[model samples]
Target: MNPLIKKLADLSEKKSRLIIGLMSGTSLDGLDIALCKISGSGQSTTVQLIEFVTAPYSEEIRKQLKRISSVENVKLKEVTYWHAKLAHLHSEMILAALRNWKITPEKVDCIASHGQTIYHYPARDQQELMDPVNSTLQIGDGDHMAVKTGILTISDFRQKHVAHGGEGAPMAGLVDQILFVHETETRILLNIGGIGNFTYLPAKNQPKEKTFTTDTGPGNTLIDSLMMHYYNKPYDEDGNVAFSGDLNEGLLRELLNDDWFEEEKSKTTGPEFFNIPWLKEKMEKAGINQDELDPKDIIRTASELSARTIVKSIQQQKITSETAVIYVSGGGAHNPYLMQRIRELMPANEVKNISEIGLSPDAKEAVLFAVLANEMLAGKGFGMEIEDESKFVNFGKISFPD
Candidate 1:
């Protein structure tokens, strides 16, 4: 028997595992490395975030990725090179973090990497394609990570979901159900990264089938794009630009006219569909020239558009009471302008960051990956039967270090 396979079997039988969860989101800002101690699995599982940090991506790396982030015309060689490069970068970050924390790589059982999402296109979004299949890709070769770090690794989680007929996103629902589902309180886990997404958690008494996850559209992607284009800033820090300018309701309305808003709640999207080009097309349709709009106003309108879609999606759920708690996470939670608008739109609900529940907003994504890896190691029968022939299942492909 192979030593790696034997080691994995031993890990599967262990009562606990130390897993490092890595996330490089659509923002391309940095890598969120979380050293998590996870014990048990399923409803009984527990995660202690022993260490966490955001290792910033250099400006050069960010630029190179931004150019090819979601475009279809990328060179195969570039993609292949970045796949290994990201793995090496992640490995270096992990090693540096381990040194800082005085822990060795051997202490860690696995690395759950959410790699970098290059593109995500569900069937609905690719209706024009002759063979429109639900597809998504995250590049950061797990094989390379395992080789560099000498730890068993799990990555490319989304591919499993797509293969099983899911939108291949908002995969957080399984982890949320495992870790955060409340017996008596209604909860919504809202994550606003480059894209805004949420998982609705009904109280135990409520039908579990009612619980679902969906993307509420743009989060920081559009605003971030405008900021970079107009101000040479990566993001509108504290939403200062939005606060400085007037809200253009007309432009806001134009932004909301996309068919996506009215589509089924199961839909998922990314910066690909909400990029500057899409915004420009919408502006033209609304007869609003780019020159006529101040950069600040553009940022403000984009911000409001995000807020409105979020509110609309939550409202569509029709929770029995206004007392449901909304735990916000991701980059948007830190943006006062965005938070204020969401609060204003949902006045009766309790709105708070995930930190209130003991997870840093910035660290939630990485931590969730840790939970998924734990599930793969120790969880059983996570698949929940849905209307379709497919069932929601545990997702991750493991790579062994040789």
Candidate 2:
């Protein structure tokens, strides 16, 4: 067997670990770093979020990142350089976070970094220019993180899932299961980040049944764009912009007609596929003036789109064995307008923040990948694809120290 495989085989039998997980979503807001103490594996797996924080990006870095994040044909050199800079920046943040908490890097067993997603083309329509069946890239030099922090670092967790005939996203499913599964109560961990993704945790009433998770639609991406485009700010504070605006019915319907929503739950998307350019095209097709359209209305429409997409998905679920409870997290949770819309859509579900369940809604994803790093180093499941995640497959890439 390969040495990596052999090492993983040795790891699967461990009982507990202290790990750090890092995530930087498409919103370009910042990196969410979570420190967790994980015990057990598989259904018995438990992740305790010990310390969490999001090290926000500086204005300059944010602007640079936004330039290439989801656009087509960006300057290659800049993207390459930023990838390393991000690793260094994240490394410094982790070191600072650890020191502030009085915890040494050695005390933590492993690190998981989701890296920065530039673009996500989830094996959708194939074309002559691309091989849609496989490929996904998240750049943030993991080796730099491992060397600087003096700990084993696991980054880029999505490739393995894609290698196994799965979309590179919605990797949140396993962590959602490990953290939220209950014997008699079903749970839906809805992360309303730049994109709205959900993990449906069936009550332990049916452990044998398959779990469900998928990206619903736009979350904060569009709302954030409207803010920057008009208000010259990063994002809408408390969703004030949307709160102040009225929804434009024509725009809302046009937004809803995209083929993104007409897919099986396995689908996924990103800003690359749903940015201002796309929305502008749609509006222009309808002869709407891009300048006259209120940025506030754009924000409101995005929020409404998120709500409608989520409701549509919930209505199509085939679940019958679990009692569904909704737990929300991410930047969107702080958006009062978005939250209100969510409650209006799913009035029956609790629709509370992940904090209500003893987890930081904002820090959950980072901590999950941290646990995934522990799994990788310890071999929770070796040479297994998600399809054979008989146990949760270990995630992350090993970053060697020099």
Candidate 3:
């Protein structure tokens, strides 16, 4: 009988809700700002992606940001300052997008912001004895965003999952279950971002209709990092870098042996584990002897790593259903070489862009946060987390219109 719960119920029953979902992934390419119209919830939910685009980041901005992304020491002042700046910058972009689309903020009910994650240190770091579930930082301050944009904002989504015994990510799983679950079909929605993650919804008609989701392994993280590092490019366009290089079988074997693959990690990871240093370690271990091993091969291997990991995860599902339609989204979807490898690996599973289902692949993640924010404002939990360890929680903190 909480007030927020009642308010959420009211919103859910409303005829329409306009939400702004913002996502800027590990690629650091730019902001993916989306405006969406959504209604219903859980499997009954319907999402209409109204407008979407990937706003290009300036090279200067990208460089400054990259310097801090994986660096150990950063001025606390700088981090706090950028968090607010990010929110404000994104708010300006939102306003610009609204103007271009002939939309009004007054028409929107809420904004879902996946604030920039400067650093995400899950509980259990060795040096910090911070209480378990103590801290994880995502700047893009929501309050600043709300004040500047004059829109009610919801953000800080991961904190809730962590409070509830989850790793605080792969939150997209909640949205996936709500929007994609079908009664007779077993579905697997794969998102190949800087990392690869998946949600498996068992055939809904089965006696024990089940759902499980997990992060398999590296996605475009290493490859993209190498591209940025060696080619002065943000990412390997069309997977060309990968296609040009020969796959180092020995290197691939050594890279695959890392402990992450051997253990069971929940469907969550970020640049934290898979970065330039991690890649270099494996390459060094493999002993890249020949000059023939250009840095591009490393990129190609990483892409293949993502494709293979996803395929392996699907196989573990013991699924017999006709091709579990794999919907690709995030930056990786556009990588042709990566997609080809994925198709070859999951020949049975139909691989198509989210656009094929009426959602722009690039905008899917942004739209998801918007939906999550809507759910939070309305005060509804999309059921409990997948396991007993997680809290059956409703996420997002709201920043009201000024």
Candidate 4:
């Protein structure tokens, strides 16, 4: 047998495994490296976030990523270059993080990389195509990561979901089902990342089909873009700009008029559909001239749009559980104004940061990918069922270090 296969078999049989999960969301902010000690698999899975850190992307790196990320057109060479370049960069960040944590690569079992998403053309967004199909693209090659880091790597996870008849996103639902389902409380694991999305985990006794995940429109993407364009900041820190500005009801309504909101609950989206251009289009439709409107007001309106769409999506679920909990995570959790809006809109349900559930909100996305890699290695069922038999297959593609 190949020594690599033998090593993988041995690792799967271990009592516990140390895995590094990497996530770089559409925000183009940085890579989230989560060093996790995960044990068991499926419903019995346990994840201890041993260490977590955000490896900040330099402005140069951010610029390059933005050029290729979610844009309608780009030079093919740029995508090809970043695919490998980003993986090496991620590998370096991981190695540096391990050193900072006083650990070594050999001590880790695997690396689960949710590579940088350059384009997420879900079937819904591909109307122009003659034969549209659900598809998404994430760079940072697993082969490069595995060879450079000398650790087994699992990357390009979304393709499997698309192949299995999913929109190739919001993969968080599977992990949430395995790790967060409650005995009596219907929990909504809301992640307000570059694109807002949530996993609806019905109480343990509920039917499986009742549990699903969907993108709740823009999370921080629009607001972050506005900040960068206006304030020259990466994000609206604490959402202060939004809090200080007055909301434009017309603009908010126009933004909500998008047909995407009315789509099926189990769906996915990305910045491609909810960027600054999209916001400006909505603004134009609302008759709000960019020259006259205060940028802060625009930011405020965008923030409200995010909050309203999120609330609207949750309400659309028609969840009968008045006691359901909305555990918020992602960069939006840190934005007090955004959280305040969500809390206000969702008064009945308890709205709390995911830290209340014992996982760092910042580390949750990265950690979940680690759980996925663990499941791929040693798990039986994915803890959920879909009509597609293809969905039952292991998610991440494996890359072995020779």
Candidate 5:
């Protein structure tokens, strides 16, 4: 047998796996490295976050990533170069994490990487008549990661989902269903990264069709973009700037008028859709002078827009029952204003950080990737049967260390 195949088979027999899950989101804030010990799979999946750290990207690195991360014309050579460059950087981060935890790379079983999403164009928009294909690209070569880290790597998980007719997003739903769902309680697993998305896991008694996930529009992307352009801050830091400013209702309404909001559920979007240019266009439409507007007000409205869109999406679900709880993760959860507003909007539903459960809210996304990787190695694969029937699709492409 090939050494790689034998090693994988050996791993499958293990009771658990020490997997390093890496997630670099659209926020470009940092690379979230989660050292996870995952056991079992599917509904029986369990994960313990052994260690975690967010290695912040230098401005130069961030700029290079952003350059290749949108519809804007970029050099193909640059994109090709950064794909491996990012993988090398990620490997360095992984090594740093291992050193920090006083562990050796050999002790780890595998690396599950979400990679860096340079573009996401889900096929939800058929009316456009331009192009209709579910396409997404996440760089950071898994082969390079595998070679550099000397660990079997599973990366580019989204491509499989797209190939299987999924929107290539909210893939965390499977893990959430396995690890976070309650027997009787309907739970909303909300992740507010650069783009906000949630997995609505109905009670076990509910029909499986009722269990769905969708992107709830802007998360921190709009606010973060404004902060960067205006204040030179990557983020609002707990939304203090937002708290200090009054909401601009007119601009808020204009921002909320995007057709993306009215589109069908289970959709996905990114900073590519909700960034500064998008906001400026909305302001222009609303007859608001972008130059004259106070920076704080813009930030305040962006934060409120995020909260409102989230609430609107939840409301669309129409999950009526006082037993539901909203478990929020991702950077937006740290924003007190956003959290308070979400709670205010949905007073009946209990809103809490995922930390109240076993997983740290900050580590949830990385941990989720780890869970998916574990499932690929050991558990029964997922058969998604919602709008379409997808059979036993195992996400992630395996890269052998050799």
Candidate 6:
């Protein structure tokens, strides 16, 4: 047998494994590096976050990524160069993090990298295309990561979901099922990142088909874009900007008027769909002059849009009778106003940070990728049968260091 295959087989049989999970969301603010100690697999899986860090992207790198991200056109050269360049950059970030933690690369079993998402055009959103298929792209090559870091690497996880008839998003459902399911309590794991999405985990006793995951429209993407345009800040720290202004009911209604929100559940979206240009078009349709309105008011309305859409999505799940626990994670969890709105909208359910359940809100996404890498190595595959008829497929393409 090849030496790499032998090493993989040996690692799969181990009692536990050390994996470094990497995530770079649509926000393009930074990369999340999570060092996790994962054991078991499937429903019996357990994970302990050993170390985690957010390596902020340099302004230069952020500018380059933004130029190609979600845009209709771009320089192909930029994409090709950055694919390999970003991998090396991420490898350096991983090495620096390992050094800070006083750990050697050899101590880690593998790296699960959710490479930066440049474009995410689900089939429903790409009607104009000649081949409108469920498609998504995340750069940063795993082969480069493996060669640079000298660790087994698993990357481009979304492709497998697309190949298996999924929209290649809200992949969290698989991990949430394994980690958050309860015997008697239905749980809603909400992640408010660049895009707001949630996994509806019905109680173990409930029909499995009732559980699914879907994106709840815009999360922090619009608000973040507004902040950068208005205040030169990457994000609204603590929702202060939003709280300072009152909501515009007319604009909010216009924002939500789109038919996309009325569609059936279990769909996916990205910044490409809900963006600054889209916001301006909605404002124009509402006859609201951007120059006349206070920037804070617009931002406040945008924040409300996020809160309303999220609550609406959760409510659409028809989860009533028993109060479900909604554990919130991602950057939006830090926004007090957003959290308050969600709580106000769902008074019966418990709304709390994911830390209440023993995971850092910021590290949850990164830790999830680590859990995914673990399953690919040693566990039986799992899936939400009702959402996609495709068979349960293992995610992540493996890259061995030579």
RMSD of candidates 1 onward, in order: 1.5, 3.0, 2.8, 1.6, 1.6, 1.2
The TM-scores of all predictions, comma-separated, are 0.97, 0.91, 0.91, 0.97, 0.96, 0.98
List the candidate 3 regions with Cα displacement exceeding 4 Å.
1-13, 124-135, 289-292, 317-323, 388-391
Q: Highest TM-score among the candidates is held by which one?
A: 6
Number of clashes found in candidate 3: 4
Where is model 5 more than 4 Å wrong at Cα?
Answer: 125-131, 207-209, 384-391
Clashes (N, CA, C under 3 Å) per candidate? 0, 2, 4, 0, 0, 0
lDDT of 4 by residue, 147-220 (tens): 99999999888888788788787888888888898887888899999889888778876755367678899999
- Runs of candidate 2 exceeding 4 Å displacement: 1-14, 128-130, 207-209, 318-322, 382-393
lDDT of 5 by residue, 266-363 (tens): 78777667788888899999999988889999999999999999989878877645788899999999999999999999899999999888788888
Q: What is the C-alpha local distance difference test score of candidate 6?
A: 0.91
Please list all clashing residue pairs in model 6, or write none if there are none.
none
Q: After superposition, how far is residue 116 of candidate 2 from its true place, in Å?
A: 0.6
For candidate 6, the per-residue lDDT at 327 reads 94
Each candidate's lDDT (Cα)? 0.87, 0.78, 0.76, 0.88, 0.86, 0.91
Q: Per-residue lDDT of 317-381 in model 6, one digit per residue for the tens?
A: 67643458999999999999899999998888889899998999999999999998998898866
- Tell me model 2's lDDT, rounded to 2 decimals: 0.78
lDDT (Cα, tens digit) per residue for candidate 2, span 162-233: 775667877788767666877888888889889888877777786676677788888888878878888888
Q: How close is candidate 5 to the true structure, as a TM-score?
A: 0.96
Better candidate by lDDT, 4 or 6: 6
